[model samples]
Target chain A: NAGVTQTPKFQVLKTGQSMTLQCAQDMNHNSMYWYRQDPGMGLRLIYYSASEGTTDKGEVPNGYNVSRSTTEDFPLRLLSAAPSQTSVYFCASSERLTVYGYTFGSGTRLTVV
Target chain B: DQQVKQNSPSLSVQEGRISILNCDYTNSMFDYFLWYKKYPAEGPTFLISISSIKDKNEDGRFTVFLNKSAKHLSLHIVPSQPGDSAVYFCAASDTMNYGGSQGNLIFGKGTKLSVKP
Candidate 1:
């Protein structure tokens, strides 16, 4: 089974352009997350959803937005892409919110020029 | 400040040798710790983990040792193989904080492990 899936494996955007990164899970997990991995910053959380219809900002959510209307989908939106926003984004899901590590998707490599 | 830190940026080891990746956390309140491995162009996957109550946990060739008092944890891969090469990340979460609904992980700068055959 595909535990977690992220669409748009690769993309290049210009500054001020907007886009969305899609994430879905077949495991029917309640908690989903969006994280970005940079060269030396590791994986920083951008947004998270504890359940369907709930979402919250994480450590690095300045230029991003997220919504969770259904249990299977949580999409991250970039209002205006910037050079600093260029990074590899990963989506993840977990069985529970209080414990357990996440199952991550392949990743979306984005470059903002 | 980064609560979690992986001092070494990268490590290299020969096949069949032991590979040790170290992680340290500044937040003493963190209870659950985890390790994740990521290949190039892929997302990081869960590797192994340890709780603050336990000092060690093992699964097959991988073992996670936690030193709560020292705020340090390490992942040891015995008889490392070429397939084991990847970027290893150290992550931690504090379940006791803010009702634990925010079970988000704080990750350290990963250490890329290269296993040569």
Candidate 2:
């Protein structure tokens, strides 16, 4: 089974453009997170959902929005793509309060010009 | 301020040798630490971990050592192999504060490890 799956593995967008990165998990994890990996920056959390219909901001929540409409799906939306937003995005999920670590998606490479 | 830090940006070791990757964290509340390895275009995968209560944990050829007093942790790979070449990241979580449910991890800038054949 696909633990976690992310779509549009690669995308390039012009500044001010908008797009959504989709994430789905078959593990039925109640918590999902969006993170951006940049050179020398590690992974910075953008947004996260503890469960369906609940979302919270992380370290870098600006310029992004997230919704957990279902236990299996949590999509990250880029309102206005900026050059600063160009980075590799990862989606991860885990059971609520699980310390076993998160299962991450392969990743989506987004470039904002 | 960055809570987790991997001072070395990259490390190189020969096959059949030992590879040690170091990590430091500033937050004293971080009790659980983990290591993840990643290849190009792929997501990071959990490698090993250590808790504050333990000084060391081992699994096969890989071992993780945690020095809570120093706020430092390290991953040791003995008899390194070419297949071990990848970026290694050190992550920490405050199970006390964030709880097991939140599980918000703080990651360090990764150290790219290369093993020469």
Candidate 3:
């Protein structure tokens, strides 16, 4: 099964450009998260969803938005993309709010020039 | 300020040796800890986890040791193989209450482990 899938494996955008990172999971998980990974900074949660139609901010949510419109899809939107947003993004899901059941996607590497 | 820290940026060891990755946390409230492994061009995958109630947990070649008193935890991979080389991240959560769910993990910078043949 495709546990978690993130599209647009790689992208480069100029400052002020906008883009959305897509995440889809077939595991029917009730929780999904978006995190950004930088060289010296580990994955920092940008946003998360507990279930469909619900979303919340995480540690670093600035300049990014998320929507959980369906049980299988959670997309992360980058508004006014800046060089500071250049990093590898990951999408993860779990059956519930637990650490043991976390499943991560392949990830999308985004570069804002 | 980073609540969780993996001071070591990278580590290298010969194959079949033991690989020890260290992590420290400043949050005493953190009750659950997890270790995730990530390779180039991939997302971090859950490797192992431990709760405050446990001192250690092991699965096959991987083992995690937790010292609550010190707020420190470590992951040990015995007989390290080349395939095990990756960036290891340490994450923790303190019974977060979020949208009727309890899973919000704070992560460390990560330590890159390289296993040489």
Q: Quick one: best DockQ, which candidate?
A: 1
lDDT of 3 by residue, B23-102 (tens): 99998878889999998887888899998999999999999999998999999999999999999999998865433333
When sorted by DockQ, best at the front, the candidate numbers are 1, 3, 2
Query: Over all chains combined, what TM-score does candidate 3 have?
Result: 0.96
Better of 1 and 3 by TM-score: 1
Residue A61 lDDT in candidate 2:
94
RMSD of 1: 1.4
Q: Write the per-residue lDDT of candidate 2 for residues B1-117, one digit (tens) a residue.
A: 999999999999999999999999998888899999999988889899888999999999999999888999999999899999999999999887673334478899999999999
Give one digit per residue, the lDDT tens place, for model 3 in A1-113: 67899999999999999999999999999999999988899988898888888898888899999999899999999989999999999999988766667899999999999
Q: What share of the true interface contacts does each candidate keep?
A: 0.74, 0.57, 0.70
Instruction: Summarize candidate 1's per-residue lDDT along B1-117 as a digit string, tens digits.
Output: 989999999999999999999999998889999999999988888889888999999999999999998999999999899999999999999977722435568999999999999
Tell me how many residue pairs clash in candidate 1: 0
User: For each candidate, what is the lDDT?
Assistant: 0.91, 0.91, 0.91
What overall lDDT, based on C-alpha atoms, would model 3 receive against the true structure?
Answer: 0.91
Question: What total of clashing residue pairs does each candidate reach?
Answer: 0, 2, 0
How close to the true structure is residue A107 of candidate 3, measured as C-alpha lDDT? 93
Question: Can you tell me which runs of candidate 3 are displaced by over 4 Å?
Answer: B96-103
Give TM-scores of chain A for all candidates: 0.97, 0.96, 0.97
Relative to the unseen true structure, what is the C-alpha lDDT of residue A13 in candidate 2, on a scale of 0 to 100?
A: 99
